[model samples]
Every structure is written in structure tokens, then in C-alpha cells.
Target: MTSNFRSLPVIALLTILSLPLVVMYAFTLVDSITDAEPGSLIPSEFTFHHWRFLWDDTTGRGSVWIATINTFIFAGSTAAIVCATSLTSAYALSRLNFPARRFFLAGVIILHAFPTITLIIAIFLILQFLGLFDTLIGVIMVKAALELPFGIWVMKGFYDTVPWEIEMAGVQDGASRFMVWRKLVLPQVQPGLSALLIFSFLSGWSEFILPLVLAPGSDAQVLSTYLAYFLLDDSLEVDFNLFKSVGLFYALPVILIYLAFQKKLMNIYGGGSKG
Candidate 1:
């Protein structure tokens, strides 16, 4: 009780520190709706001109709808591929005996340790060689590949926590190895699976550098690239409200996804599977 009471000051301090970020978001939100001049505290007038761009993209480059569909494809495919491959790779590393297994486990984390920027040149060259450059499918492959190392390590951690006796019991009940894995082992790591899905999806959703460098222009643009286009196009007449509107629009999907799966995020760090 005393400790709880003593923590109030710390909490108050943290809240105070967070005020600037809250104010910034509030300002942006207000700016998106009102015809407020840049750096003004109050709006001169309110209008929906900023949001109207969603249905009617006036930039004449490409439709927001197309970019949105492309984003969903890129993010969804990246998550699915990363989760699927990571599950199998992590399971083999965690449950099976193989030479250099520990080394490989360490190696996956090591691969994640290198900064992604350093590998962009190599990735670009590889994609070019494979005839995948400047295409959405190519970007999907690159994003999935980048996400694999972390996903494998996370799933491996969860897999290591599953009891071996469960698998043996399934085997004793005339279940094949694949069946045991599918039925018993996989459910034990549902939390990890959920975490990986959200992480991989968000990673691909917000990825800027890869999409900008590899899959540029209107044809293969994702929401991130789409938002950037607003900045590039507004040189002569900068519309801060429009930029803020685009920023909010780009972030809406990720926000909704997180809200939908926030409960499962807590489960990721919680204890092992229930009976």
C-alpha cells in the first residue's frame, strides 16, 4: 500500500513528460479538420477539404484506393509468409536434433543484429538479378525475408516452453509427428503466433525505405510511399492540413489492427498455455 502510494509522483512525472506528444497529436488532428494556418493555436475555419482527398485523390498521380489495396497485399502477404516459415524453422530448431542447431539459432539472431540499411544495396541487387525490382511481389518477398530472423527467434522461444511429454502423449495415441505438431504443439504457442502476425504486419505496413527504394512510383506504391508523395508534390503550395490528413489516413489501418489484437499482445508475455 505504501509502495503504491509512493508511485504516484513517478506516474505524475511521466504524464507530464508525455504531454508534448499528446499536444502534437491533438494539433495535427485539429489541423486535419480546420483550415488553420501553420503554427496557429486556433483555427480560422473548419472544413472537410483535407479528408475529401480520400475519395477524390486530386494529385493525378494514382488512386489512394489502389495504393491501399497494394498496402494490404504487401502487409498481409509478408505476415503470412513470415509466420508460416518462422513456425517451421523455429520448430525444427527447438524440437529436433540436428548438427549446428545451436549455431543456427545464434545465427538467426545475429542476422537480425545487422542494421537493415546496410543490406539495402545487396537486397536491391539481388531483386534486380531475380527480375523482381520495382514490383509489389518483389517488395513482399524482401519484407518477408527481413522479418524472418526475428520471427523465428520469437517462435523458437515459445516452442522451447512447450512440454515434450505432450508430443509423446500424442505419439502414443497413434498420432503421426506432423499431426502431433499440428494439433498439440502449435496451440501451445498461440500467443507467439499472434505476436508474430501483428509484428510482421506492422513492420511491412510502416516500412518506408524498402518500398521507396525498391518499389517506387505510382504503380507499386504502398501507403507509406503514398504519404511521401504528398510531401514531394506540395513544393509550390504546401498544404499542412492535407499532409496531416494523409498521415492520419496512412496510420488508421495499423491503429485499428492494434486495437483489435491488443488483448493478445498481453498474452504474448504471459505464462505458458492453459490446460
Candidate 2:
């Protein structure tokens, strides 16, 4: 009797939990099938035109190639810079001792919590002063800096979970500090690094505010800006279904990648994030 009662509650809880997801999926499915104007949710019939149209795009206005490349470049460069700067520096903070280390570590974390939007004006002025306003490389550098602090903090926690004695043993064997970290420490934190790469790439990939504020022309524009272009275009009629189609295609690859690696991300960001 007790077992049956417990099972009933468990089943009830699962049904309740699943309700929101079912609703959301139904909404997305309806959105995909509908051909009405941007505001309408109902469709006369199902259509595959949007999906098929992505490949046939020659309008120049809807070219996925350009925006795809921009996204890749931004995400790739940001991940590289974040991993390079954060991995080594964070390892140093975690394993090595120095004066003012705690203060420095706290500041690193505090800076990680700083919102990216708040940096826009300051970054804009700085880039303007350096004569790099609206440059792809400049945006890449800013994204890298934005990613560095959080990446370092995530890595620091991952490093703590690794036994320091492993690196210490390397040191006692006459291995230089640099060599010990490179060969020994890094290998232990590869999972966290992978998670960091995925996350930092996603952030750079999806970030719109900074690039929107900073990108001076199409030369430096990424996917986010390109998406907004459709809404802003006065020359062409706004096509809501086409906009949603483009969005889904652009988002599909990243979504798949995230889903594939989602199970490990919590551990990367949470499970091992403490001293």
C-alpha cells in the first residue's frame, strides 16, 4: 500500500514537471509550421519552404555564409584567448603562492561578475582612442577579456579538485614549475577546459549587445547583428516566418553541441568551483 502511494506521487510529480516542456515544444512546433505574417500564430498549412530556402539563398540579404563565418571567428578566437589567458594564470593562482594572492584572487572573481553591458561605453571610448573601433580583431579582444575572468575562476576550481601533490611531485623531481604545470596539471583539468571552451564560445557566439554597440559597419558584423538587420530593413518587407527560419538554422548547430555536452557543464561550473 505504501509503495503504491509513493509511486503515485512520483508519477504525479513527473507529469507536473513535464507540462511546461510539452507546452514550449508545442509552441515552437506551431511557430515552425505557420506561414502567416510575423505576428500570427496560426497557419493555413504546414510549409517546408523556410527550411529549403536556407540553401537557395542568393538574395545577398539572406546569405548564411557570411554570418556563419563571423560567428565562428568570434567564438573561436574568444575561446582561444580565454583558455590561454585563464588556464595558465588561474593555475598559478590555484597552485602557486605569492603576496596579496587572496586579494588578487577575490578581485579576479569580482571582475568576473561585472556585467558586459556596463563595459560598453568605456570599451567603445577605449577602442575609439586606439583607432580600432568597428574592427573584428578589436571585438575579439574585448570578448576574450570578458571571458577571461570567469574562465579562470572555473579552471581554478577544477584545479583545486585535482590533487596538488601530483604537481608537487613533478616539482620535487627537478621539473621546472612551468613544465610541471604544462604536462601534469593541464592533463588533469582537460574536462573543465572542454566545458570552458564550449561555454566561452557560446557566450561570444550569442552576445549581441557589445557587438551591436561597437561594430561600426558590416565589415565587423556578426550573426546577431545580421539577424537584427532583417527587422531594421526598410527597403524590403519584413518576413516573420523567414526571420524565425533563419534564427532556427543559425541556432541549430550550437544547440546540438550544447545538448551533447550539457551533462558535463554543471560539474565544470558548479561541482568543482570551490577551493
Candidate 3:
């Protein structure tokens, strides 16, 4: 009871600080489903007109569902590739002692330090050379490659936390190195794995610039790119309500994913090694 009493001020302070965001989100939600007079903030009447893009190609670029499907595929593929490669590479980095291991680790950090925008022109040219420009698979590969350094570093930290005894025990029992890693080490770092998976998925899902710059076709359009069409179109009078609805639609999956795995996401920093 005393702890609760003591926490009241902190809770109240947080609530006060968050009030504007809360109100803004509330207003957005309300505004999406309701009509407002020009130059007026208050919603005047409820309507589903703004949400028609769900079924209609109102943007003329493509159906919202196509963008959604592409977004899902991009995010899901990136997450899968990152997780699979990160786990194996991190295990090797943590458990193996190859030449230039430290140099490799240093290089990983250096690679991650460079911003994505700086590499875009080179990546764009490389994709063009490979005949992969403006392709979904091309963008997926780029996103996964850019994400790998962070994924490998984080997974290595988690791998460092796993005890050698468990792995040794498996080896002593006639298990191969692959078997030990798959059955023992993998299970121990489940939290980090789950967290990394969710994080990578969220990263790919929210990525705007890469998809916009790389995969501009309607066939490869992701939600982030699709959402930008509304703001960029000069032909249509600005429809703020429709924009809000589309924004809400784009954000719903991310919100749901975060809410569902919030605990695991929070654990990302808990077990990782500093070095």
C-alpha cells in the first residue's frame, strides 16, 4: 500500500506528460471515422468514406491490400533471414576461435555505424547491375544485409551469456557440435531470439526510405511507400481524413505486434553483453 502510494506521483507525472499524445491519437482516431468542416478541428458527423481505400484503388497507384501483402512479405522475409543467419553466425562468433575474429567483430560494428542513406546510391547501382533494381526480392536482400550487423552483434551478446557447460555436456554425450547448438544453446537464448525477431520485423515493416527509393513499382509497393502517395499527389485536393485513416491502417499491425511481444522486446537489453 505504501509502495502504491509512493508510485502515485510518478504515475500521475507520466499521465500528465502523455496526455497530449493520448489526445492527439484520440483525435486522429475520431477524425478518421468522422467528417469535419473545413478549417474546423471538431468532427461533425461519422462516416466510413475515408476508409474506402481498403476495398477501392482510390490512390490510383494500387490496391491497399497489394501494398499490405508486399509489406508483410518484405518484413517477414527480412525477419526470417536475419534470425536464421544471425543465430548461426552469432554462435560461431561466440563459440569458435577463428583467425581475425576480433577484426571481424570490429568490422561488424563499423558496418553498422554507417547510415543507410549513405549506402543507397551504391546499393541502387549494384541492384541495377544485377538486374534487381526496383524488385521486392532485391529490396528484401538489401534490408536483410543492412540489418545483419546489428542482429549478429545482439545475438552474439546473448550467445555469450549461454554457459559452456551445457554445450560441453551435449558434446560429451556423443552429440555433434551442430546438435548441441541446435538443442542446447538455441533454447537458452530464446528470449534474445524472440526479441530480435520482433525487432527485425518491426524495422522492416516501418522502413520507408528504402522501399520508397528502391522498389517504387506498384507490384512491390509496401505500406510505407503506399502511405507516401497520399502526401505526394498533387492531382487530388488534400484529404486529411483519408490520410489519417490510412496512417491508422498502416500502424495497426505494428501496434498489435508491439503489444503482443512487448515483454520480450523489453528483454532485448537485459541479457546482452557490453563487449
Candidate 4:
């Protein structure tokens, strides 16, 4: 009871600090569903008019559902690829003793340090040369490739936490290296893997520039790019309420993902510090 009492001040401080963000989000929600008088900040009437984009194809870039589907595919594919490649690569990096292993690890960190924007022109030219411009697969591949360094580094940290005895036991029992890794090492680092998957998915989902620059077609559009269209329209009268609704819609998945995997996400730091 005393501990709980002592924590109240910290909680109160946090709540006070968060009040503005809470109020802003509340106003955004209310504004999306309610209309204000011409000159008033207060909502005057309740309506679903701003959410009409959910049913109507008014954006002229195709249905928001198309963008949503493309986003899911792009994010899902990147997560899967990052997970698959990182698992094996990190395992090798953690357990194997090959020449220049330290140098390779250093190179991985260097690659991740470079901002994605700096390489956009080169990536754009390469995609065009490969005839993959304006395609979802092209963007997915690029996102996965870019995400690999971080994924590998994180997974390696987790793998380093695993005991060698467990692997040796499996090997002594006549299990192949693949079987040992698949059954033993993988389970121990499940938290890191889960965290990486969520991180990669969120990274891909929130990505705006790559899709905007490399895959500009309506069919390859993701939610982030779709949201930009609201302001890109040449009309002088922009519907701010509609923009808020679209922003909320775009954010809903990320919010849900965080709520669901928040615990695993915390484990990322725990695993990283182990190595």
C-alpha cells in the first residue's frame, strides 16, 4: 500500500505531461465524427461525413482498401523475409568462427548507419534498370534488404544469450546442425524474433518515401502514400476533418500492433544488452 502511494506522484506527473497529447487525440476523434460551426473550435453536430472515404472512392487513386491491402502485403513480406534471413544469418554469426566475422559485423553496422534517403537515387536507377519500378515486389524487396542489418544484429544478440550446452547436447544425440538450431536455439530467442517481426512490420508499414519514390502507381500505394494524396490535391479547400480521419485510419493498425506485442517489444532491449 505504501509503495502504491509513493508511485502516485510519478503517475500524476506522467498524466500531467501526457494531457495535451490526450486532448489533441480526443479532439481529432471528435472532429472526425462531428462538424464545427464555421468559426468555432467546438463541434456543433455529430456526423460520419468525414469517414466517407471508407465506402466511397473519392480519392481517385483507387479505393483506400487497395492501398491498405498493398500495405499489408508489403509489410508482411518484409517481416517474413527479414525474419527468415536474420534467423539463419544471426545464428551463423553468433556460433560460427569464420574469417573476417568481426569485419562482417562491422560492415553490417555501417550499412544500417546510412540513411535510406541517401541511397534513393541509386536504388531508383537500379529498379528502373531491372524493370521493377512502380511495383510492390520491388519495394518489398528493397524494404527487406534495408531492414536486414538491424534484424541480423538484434537476432545475433539473442542468439548469443543461448547456452552452447543445449546445442552440443542435440548434436551428441545425432541431430543435424539444422535440426539442433531449428528445435533448440530458435525457442530461446523467440522474444527477440517476435520483437524483430513487429519492428520490421511497423517499419515497412510506416515507410513513405520508398513507396512514394519507387512505386508510385495506384496499385502499389500503401497507406502512408495514400494519406499524402489528401494534401497533394490542387484544390484550395482542403477538408481538415477528412484528413484527420484518414490519419487515424492509417494509425489504427500500428496502435493495435503495439498494444498486442508491447511486452515482446520491451524484450528487444533486454536481448540486445545480453551481447
lDDT of 4 by residue, 1-275 (tens): 35646787898999999999999999889999999999899999999999999999886878999899999999999999999999999999999999999998999999999999999999999999999999999999999999999999999999999989989999999999999999878888988999999999999999999999999888889999988988887763589999999999999999999999899899987883321
The CA lDDT of each predicted structure is 0.88, 0.80, 0.92, 0.92
TM-score of each: 0.93, 0.84, 0.95, 0.94
Cα deviation of 88 in candidate 2 (Å)? 0.6
- Which pairs clash in model 2? none
Residue 38 in candidate 3 has what lDDT? 86
**Comparing 2 and 4 by lDDT, which wins?**
4
User: How well is each residue in 10-81 modelled by candidate 1, as lDDT tens digits?
Assistant: 989999999999999988899899985567778999899988768896877588889989999999999999
TM-score of 1: 0.93
Ranking of all candidate structures by their lDDT, best first: 4, 3, 1, 2
Candidate 4: regions farther than 4 A off:
272-275
Worst 10 residues of 3 by lDDT: 266-275
TM-score of 3: 0.95
User: Which pairs of residues collide in model 4?
Assistant: none
